[model samples]
Target: MNNPPSGGAGPDLSVTIAGIRFRNPVIAASGTFGYGREYQGLLDVSALGGICTKGLTLRPRPGNTGNRIHETPSGILNSIGLENPGIPAFLEKELPALRELGPVVIANLSGADPEEYAEGARILGASSIDMIELNISCPNVKAGGMAFGLDPEMAASVVGPVRRAAGGKPLMVKLSPNAPDLAAVARACVDAGADALSLVNTFKAMAIDIYRRKPVFDMVSAGLSGPAIRPIALRMVWELGNALELPLIGVGGIAGPEDALEFLLAGAAAVQVGSATFAHPAAMLETIRGIRDYMEKGAFLTVGELSIRQKSPRARDRSGNTGSPPQGG
Candidate 1:
């Protein structure tokens, strides 16, 4: 892993999360990158922590009809509606091909209801996938009536069966910032059966075409992602870190090594790079390189060393003092 590519010198970037070993802390966020194979020609995908495939459903979905993706100032709004090729096709075809790719494979599953979620977990758990990320929350589709993530009770209830079906494979629940009380819901998920957690899927946002005087998305609202959501996500990740003993994977608006470091300091076991992948196909590789560079300069030996938390300068400044001097090089 010491070989240098177009990115930077790859250091000892390995880290273990929920007992799953990853070559690096940077994972390719789901939806942004297709089932890990799409970028085979770009760079080495295996160098990443893991490849999280697009959200999967029980059956194939045609997805939304019009204007599924729209670019925003600092981010992107999407209403892809969990479009997937269905689990059966994934098991028969995609899974085999993805295995040949390097790095760990994390299967992200979404279902119309609790039963489907349990079934998907049962099948995937028995497969070669390294982990299962339950989509208890996604903000794009309003037509589903309920996302199963908004209510702590519903989210908590769904995990037990999925955990049983998972057959001991690590189960990480994706969290929604749209929840009325995010921390409460997170606690519920942990108590129910989650081994780890990934969070801040996307904020519920909407756009307007002034000329048409109508919503830009056919679904009326879409999931907002990118650098725009990083601050809020950092806060939430910190809050969760304070409230739970479980590993947390931070997502939302992480565009560079600095952002990833912020999440780590706030207590994220690891962080995922999402919208940035759309702008730079090799972004994950670059992020891995950047993290290595930062770590080397700081004389950190591993990702666990990256979790050192510094006192907030804002709080100190408010109390009439400068912040703590920057520690890392």
Candidate 2:
């Protein structure tokens, strides 16, 4: 995967998330990428830096009934509730095929309790998988989703056991933006020994069906994602980046390379292509190329050279201090 193009058009797009390195910052978000085999027919899977598998659980889950997804203005609302074939099935069927892609395979695991998380983590940890993303922020699930992610204690409990189970393999705790103070939860995960963090998972939202005189989905609430949530995700990334020194993966509402750049500028070491993947299967690849183009145009040497801080006149005071600009100068 490191075979670069002939000319040195720009710096390599490959970036490191946690301690594991990726070919590029473009990763197919969990739930959207399925098992990574489906896209094999459409594009080269090896071209991607990583693939985050659908949210897995200790036991198989059928997810919710009725309409699981709905389209909105500039986004989509999903109440899929994390339906998956369980970790055992994923390892048995999905793992072998994904291994052939020659990129990092990040298993996204969710649980109703800490023990369940540990069990899933241990099972996947023993495998050839590159990492495990603890999805504690599925807003659609009633018991084990965003609830566990909202409380710092619960988040730590869930991540701590998984970290132990991972036993040195990278463990990334995916956080919810709906939480009052995402930084607090991020700090807790860091304290619990998480290798890295992915922030602004998804925000809880709803859509009504006027013609049907009821809610669009059976669950009445869904996780909102896509361009609409970019600002929220950016703010969370900035907050968490400032609060903790740990590597961050920004996820919410990233559609193109510019959006990815915003997250990087907000302190994300890398980013995941989530809902945008649903609309454009080639989105991740395009994002990778776009970032490369951006770097070359800006005369940047590496993704690491991009600062997270906003570069504005207001950012500098009259005395050129790093603090806020002088008042009414």
Candidate 3:
């Protein structure tokens, strides 16, 4: 038998975020892909728009002591505590290999305070990394973790200096779902200096071991992610898209193309795959293929085309009601 349609490139999957063009809109999220080294020999790294490295700090961290990750009904709660080998090691060890392997490399930087954030950005910007993702939304740590992300002023305090430090490179701020006002916080980051925004980082969660009579994680609380947060993430993306004019990346619990499509239609410039990678090593590659197949079937030529189709007037409010103009006004 002849080749049974293994499939080749079908449509133009390229997407641009903050003036950076990615081969596809599906990018590997930080803290999950491990600096693009783990996925080596498993999938084409270059096929992705970019790779967001595990959240990096100024110094190496030992991470949480006790139980780290726990599987829930439809999601995973993690207390990894931003475990990383620090920025110096990443530059000296991981950056070269990733650059050689291809794909746009985005460095995810985190710090306990604004100074640390600026310093890390200043250092990473000097490297070959194509972009910097300021992970201000991490909820696992106790110090300045989500504290800097929840309030608009606090978000700006971290973003302004980092953006100035990373003047030459794209500086994207990752938004926290724990914030009382995600849209206001997003605006603050942009007004302060962020080049792009990524929304709906894992929700705050905790799991108790009833048999053990204690918390499952040493940190007492963890970040909940996976399919469980998809609906919330999608709603935020749609609202944030309506609020902000800059490029927004949708993330939370995307496991497949259908989830990504919701984000795209809601106004995301791209989607980041996180927890699903743990279950399937080739999840991102599969997502890319599925997206291409969906586009081809729908006769869609570009991601922008697909995104536009869903930007109609049928948008609903948080109450699940159509948001029509006021009749009395």
Candidate 4:
């Protein structure tokens, strides 16, 4: 894998999360990048640090109906409801090509229940996928997604089963920003055997369609994502980084290289570019280039060094008073 494209002379932008070394720290967020094939002709998929497939479930779901997406000033609300082509179909059809896509392939796994999540993980555990992104924070789904993520005990209950079922594969739990106690949930996931954590899933939001005198989406609430959520997402990453020692993948409204640099500086080992990809397909690649440039200019040799959380005493002091207290008392 050490070829010209993967290996060049510059400040290394690569990041290693959960023992998986990505070529760079700019990954395509799940739901935005569909299985890495939809964007095959749009940009060089191999140039990405990683690709997270759409949220997958044990059984095929038709997803929610009636305006699953709505655009806002700086973000979009979505109620896709985990609509996906069951795990079996993904294993048979998508996994093969995804294996050849050249970037780290992370399966964004979700389900309606703990057992369903476990079964899906069991199936994926035997596959050749690079890592498993345990998505316990999907806000739009009513059944189990965010339900399992909101509380520390609830999150641990779900993570324990999936962890054992993952067959020792790297497990990175995606978190919901809506959780009342986000740090407690992170600590629970880690205690339950999670290797890494990604933060700031869309906030729960809604909009009214005055013309129809109804809601913009069938479900009254949907997941909010985009530049509108980036600042808050960065703060969440910063808070978690100060509280835990796990690798973090920051997601939410990351549109450009400067935005991504903010998350890394706030302590994210990697940043996932989502909504921006809809407007610019090469956003991730541009971010990768931008990060390399930033690193070179700052004399930061590795992605880990880009973190100002631990290296700066001021950041540490600020973190102590940021939000709620750190994980353990």
Give lDDT tens digits, candidate 4, residues 1-329: 21223346877676777778888898999999999989888888888989999999998999998889899999999999999999999999999999898999999999888899999999999999989999999989879999999999999988999999998799999999999999999999999999889887899999999999999988899999999999899999999888887788899999999999899878787889999999888788778878877777777777776766644333322112121111211
Q: Write the per-residue lDDT of candidate 2 for residues 255-280, one digit (tens) a residue.
A: 88899988876767789998998878
Highest-scoring model, TM-score: 4
TM-score between candidate 2 and the true structure: 0.90
lDDT of 1 by residue, 1-329 (tens): 23333344544577677778887788888888898888877777767778899998778887887898899999999999888899889888899988888778999988877788889898898999999989878887653313677888888778888998889898999999989988999989998888889987999999999999999999899999999999999999998877777778999999888889898777677899999988877777777778888878887666665665554544321112223324555
Model 1 RMSD in angstroms: 6.2
State the number of backbone clashes in model 4.
1
**lDDT score at residue 183, model 1, on the 0-100 scale:** 91
Candidate 4 ranges with C-alpha deviation above 4 Å? 1-7, 311-329
lDDT for every model? 0.81, 0.82, 0.83, 0.86
How many residue pairs clash in each candidate at the backbone level?
2, 1, 0, 1
Model 4 — TM-score against the truth? 0.92
Q: Relative to the unseen true structure, what is the C-alpha lDDT of residue 266 in candidate 4, on a scale of 0 to 100? A: 85
Off by over 4 Å in 2: 1-9, 310-329
Tell me the deviation in Å of residue 227 in model 3.
0.4
lDDT leader: 4
lDDT, candidate 3, 1-329, per-residue tens: 11111346676787777667787889899989998878776666766778999999888877888999999999999999998899999899999998886778999999989998899999998999999999889999987778899999999999999988887898888999999988889989989988788987889999999999999998899999999999999989888877866778899899988888878767677899999989977778777877787778877776766664233356542212222221110
